[model samples]
Target chain A: MYTRILVSALFAGACAGLIAGILQLYFVQPVLLHAELYETGALSHFGAVPISAHPELPGFDLMRDGLSLIFTMLIYTGYGLILLALMSLAEDRGAVISGRSGILWGIAGFVAFHLAPGFSLPPEVPGVAAADVTVRQIWWFATVGCAAAAMWLIAFGANWMVWGLAAILLLAPHVIGAPEPEVFAGPVPTEIAALFAARAFGVGLAAWVLLGCFAGYFWQREGVYADATQSA
Target chain B: MTTMTNTRSGLRILPALFALALGGAVIALTGHVQAAALHDAAHDVRHATGFPCH
Candidate 1:
């Protein structure tokens, strides 16, 4: 069971991570690179004449971009391992696991990890004003935890009371509120920031759906093999 | 048969726990670590994935 879980997660994570990395490279990275120009004062949003017709956006560095790709794969693999473990537990409780249902699982993951926290702390671009990293990190972790528990309750809980509790869990972090900068300030333009957040969410949704599909497919395949071996 | 099933399920707990732990550590390293060098290394991704960065 352990080997099966590990193998499935690895394959699912790698495949999803590869695609997610490429998507980010194509759809998201340009926005980020443009924002960095503003951040570094290479281009200024405020009252400064334009630097040049075409400010040289940093071209591809193999090392930096390559590492980013690898790191993305590793991060998703980790997500996969955790997700698969939970799915195994659910399966033990007789919940059906499959590619069709995996999309739902992936969406739940995005909600817990991204949307829930983001409601309080929208994705930031370079030069954006922000709270201290440590405090924000704590809040982010708490939000993810609460949101995940709430999702689990919603999925498995039997009664309204349980569902009500789930609702509270989902709301608690927002009620507490996310940490904020003393004043909202940044060189990055609102348009860029908005685009960044939107693109990030879009990429995240696509990646997670793919991850869920792969995980479910691999898990079901492994289960079939296990059954065959047991019967044999 | 019931006892066998119970034993098998019971043995599953350790691996499940292990998977959770391992997965969590990787996430923390990639998404949550505060070390400057690591942060610099993962800077672009940290921002791209919306993991909160400086």
Candidate 2:
């Protein structure tokens, strides 16, 4: 039973991690490259590089980057934990796939993220073009928030307190707005937003811990004796 | 008479109360209106399948 749980979680985590990595490579990376090209004409030559135009690995850079890795791990961890949690429910009832419960949880989480804002780390150098900021900043937060919340509520519960608290803890700084310090004496518009994304992803890491515990409970199975069948 | 009394007693309010609580919870949790992203995604997904949610 324990081995099954571990195997299921590892499989789920690896798959989720790979998918997340691919998304970063194919979608997010190109967008970043485009933003850089729009900002500094000098960087346009670098942007012409096919590698920059297309990200071949999604979550690899995310894993390597100190901040991005945190989010990638959160996604991977969440998937594994969720799988475990559903497995536990089946163990309690019987050793079978509770397809209904599993799909319900998955859909719920997916929907929550869809409704919430997207999130991502901001670039170090501020860009001159408004398009770059607007596209990356607003869209990313909205999309990520929606996606994260959907996943969270399903994996956790519909308890508004849990949902709202998770959202606030993860996204408050960005969603509520952050105060930018002027020690650098520079206007960095995406700094606060990026902070919020980073913080929210951190909260997601904590949530994944809950996922692991719940998964363990759900996947725990009781031994069945052959003689027990006589009672039925 | 005893069986009728027992049957009446067995039909308790707990299940009804539990159902009410669950329903209330579902409403409370989902009541907070969200942005259009989910709806948009659903729309897109549905359109691709030629079965629009609209």
- Best candidate, lDDT: 1
What is the TM-score of each candidate's chain B when compared with the real chain B? Answer: 0.86, 0.42
CA RMSD per model (angstroms): 1.7, 15.3
Clashing pairs in 1: none
What are the per-residue Cα lDDT tens digits for candidate 2 across A191-216? 33244234333333333333444334
Q: What lDDT score is found at residue B44 in candidate 1?
A: 82
Largest DockQ belongs to which candidate?
1
The number of clashing residue pairs in model 1 is 0
lDDT of 1 by residue, A1-232 (tens): 8988899999999999999999988888888898888888777865656444345677778988898889889988988998898888888888899988888999998898889998998877878999999899889989989998999999999999999999999999999899999997788878888999999889988998988888888999998999999999
What RMSD does model 2 have?
A: 15.3
